[model samples]
Target: MEKNAAELLKKYLSGQCTPEEKAMVEDWYLQLPFQKKAPAAEQIEASHDEVLDRLKQRPKTRGIGYLKHIAVAASILLCVGLGFVLFNRKIEPMAGLAKKKLEDVLPGGNKATLTLADGSVVDLDKALNGEITKQNGIVIRKTENGQLEYIIQDDPDAVSGTNTIATPRGGQYQVSLPDGTKVWLNAASSLTYSYPFAKNERAVALQGEAYFEVAKDKQRPFKVRANQQIVEVLGTHFNVNAYSDEPMQKTTLLEGAVKVVAGGNEVRLKPDEQAKFNAASTELVVDKNIDPDQYIAWKNEVFAFNNEDLKSVMRQISRWYDIDVAYKGKITTEKYFGEIPRSANLAEVFKILELNHVHVQVSGKTMTITGN
Candidate 1:
């Protein structure tokens, strides 16, 4: 079977293969069988090194004709080599792959709580669209898209009231503050602000993650307080990640400029810059010329990972799925590179992770990371 498959693949690579023969080779590759037992780490590492050395020895060519051969070889080698890498990492073949469907957990959606100044809490998820309540002569309505919007009324005596919106784990929400500033609160986040804005400044306190589009009001500076850090802006776009569990708080600027104050330090950020604040340190580290889109990708319902480690990736999964994560032993430091749609179920996500040699067991709302 190996000899026949190799012959077919070789013919296909030569560009002289028939359509039926090409299809046969593709089918064989796609159905490559998984080994019942995993290979040792050293053996897998040797295979990986061997593949790299062989590829590096191949003669370089600028001719387009050589491109197809290189592509074919690279594709086939990656599949076979990656399989070995995964097997070695796990130290055991995947189990319950076919039985992971006992129950699948769905992703988060727009759900939050709206706390009025009177200390009344309304569940936005259960509230009907339009006219949830009225306070300080301002009308609060739940939009058709599950967003919370404010409508200011004409009342000279009306005093601006404070309100808070909070999203629990497995939830998200968007809101248009009384000053027209737009905010998207990520899962396990909250935003608190005074409605109708005060005369001097507009401020909001945030916990967890949020993307903000500050309504340009040069007269009133927009300030967001996330823990001990404060980001002051004058009509700009930015994202703030202040999850309590995270090691550092990050404020990324997408447009305009902002002054970040944290840990007895301050920095003015330009466009496409990220300021990181560690509570233990008295300095703000700013990363310039970064892709701000990566910071705000969650607002678009995408889990974007760029060479992220397993623990960091799982942290996001835990919040989005509202599941507890436990490692059977020492956690893996393996890095992953890929993007997964936020709409995928927990089972679907685990299936992809399994390809990377990550073994997991899901029971109720708990996920045990058994290996790799």
Candidate 2:
């Protein structure tokens, strides 16, 4: 197998890298042994961050796997090296961030749920915003703004079974927990709140998709139980996307720390980091490069894809607008990188794609993608 710059650098770093990765790195570094630097060289300086960034990513693409994931550990360690060269460049400043369209969002999709302490279930997608038919020992109140708020007063003895709040196709909702923890539920997701709720610790069961801004309570930790994995925290904000369609479940931390437990393995994630778990393989991965703006786009009411592709982007649009997407293989290996406001009309969303030269035709609720 041929090795790239990433592979070469990993091997040049010695046994510091895994044996499986050494070959790829050795090949790339061997090509530039005499030059000592990369072919696409940046300005050389210890004080410039780009220099350090190049140094860090120099060998990252060399077949980085789960076993080697803990290897990179984000830019925390490389900050000093990156700081040496970054923030000192005399380049022109740009706008902070602009709004994006509906077609933009990271792949892997989202989740949400509707709960009844009695165990009876109501799919959020099928349920209307208003009075949900009452069940045993519980009252369901759907806000006009489309947030599902459940109130349980009669269950003094604590219910045994869990009441699930799930979102179906073409659905999205938000929840403000009693503790003031705001959760945004994406399409086709569900979460179960503990019965009578924990007195000391505020815990909840989650599946599909949800983002949490946990109310700070040091005395009682907030626990989110997802498929196969458990996210434990006291007071922190993070996003968990555990869609059943995909074999992987991901938890991205925007602020505060979170411990992702998957298959007896535990990985701690810091702020601005994401932990991706493969359920089929029972593997845990850590991606350090997180764009909070991109991750929290839904919160701010926008669609943002950092560096996503056509298929991935299409799925996101389907979830948000509740549409079926069809595309031919003509647009193979094409990438879309842009943002659009969520409030924009569907036409506006399609315009972004047209501008990128991806011929798209939208009719009613169905849109097809053709051409690269």
Candidate 3:
């Protein structure tokens, strides 16, 4: 039997519904098949419109990449308004979106996930930093040094070794391979490497943010599998961020030659070159004049913004900190130019904004801004 929406909403409002009841309401509202162009929707949509404006003004967008990316968007959107409500006008009710925030992270941060070869999954968000999980001949441990590492399975055929490491939104980790190939996994990112990566060929799978300084292997060629693309190189330094939300899977070459292949399309890049991949359209583009710091700053414990918009900026913040963003009024489409050190206090981030004439406010963990 189908439950009435009004009844379910009232039950939720009164806190008289079970967990199941609340979920049913959320599913019904958010998953509605028909997109009704309601008149009231427009009248009250300013709040959300303001959010969209703020998002557009900042710089770029993850572009409905998936649910994981959208989770923190609302938090960053509504961050400024959160300190105090907009004057007088009825705030547009993002019922469906609001409910999602409750079901996910409220604001300030997100969680991560770990998958084993055996198909077991660990939610890294709730778990502590050290000694997370182990399985499938893989010893998953957080070293006393406070980084996530995988001990490759020992096998008779294993002349060399490899393993995979991945991180999800509201999550980040670092790893040091036996051969001293250091990797830093960013929010909503993943990587896979072989044990004693073979002499002839070295390969790994990656999505999202990672900084790699490949060990010099004369005999073996290192490769990274991301989305449908593969990046091949022998010895070099580089960063890859291929979040599904963004339009492209970017491979930024720091100091070596790398061949990026998308589908049958292939392109080679030299130092200071970046390969961009579009997952939806499956287009490959070779871009010159790249910014290496802005691409790989996360590895250095910093979030660098270079002429980026609110939507795009919020996307990064949403993933690392796992929050929701909303807004009221006109969402200005503008670009922000700044380099925020990851270790910088929240006040520092706002201070930079204030200096730029970008109005910003912080309430607790949520950070918001008003565009000019």
Each model's lDDT: 0.73, 0.59, 0.58
Quick one: ranking by TM-score, best first? 1, 2, 3
1-372, model 3: which lDDT tens digit per residue?
A: 323434545676678977766654433333211224211223233344454555556433221222113222122222222211122222222235323333343222323455555556666555576666544444567666556665666655444334556665666777766455778788878777665556578778887778888878877788888778888887889888878788668999989788889967999998878888887787899888556666887776666665566778778876766554445445555555434555543333333333122444444445455544
How does candidate 3 score on lDDT? 0.58
Task: List the candidate 3 regions with Cα displacement exceeding 4 Å.
Answer: 1-114, 120-141, 149-164, 194-200, 327-329, 345-351, 354-372
Per-residue lDDT tens digits for candidate 2, residues 56-123, read 56543221121122222111122122211122222221112211322332222223445566446666
lDDT of 1 by residue, 1-372 (tens): 123334444576677777666654443343222222323334433454555565466442111122222323222343322221221122232357433642368898988999999999999999999999988889999999889999889888898788999999999999998888899999999999997888889989999999999999989999999998999999999999999888789999988999999988899999988999988665689987456777787998877654456788889999998988888866656554345678888766655444334567767788888653
Residue 25 of model 1, lDDT score? 45
Question: How many clashes would you count in candidate 2?
Answer: 26
Candidate 2 residue spans exceeding 4 A from truth: 1-140, 150-161, 199-202, 218-220, 246-248, 355-357, 361-365
Output the better candidate (2/3) by TM-score.
2
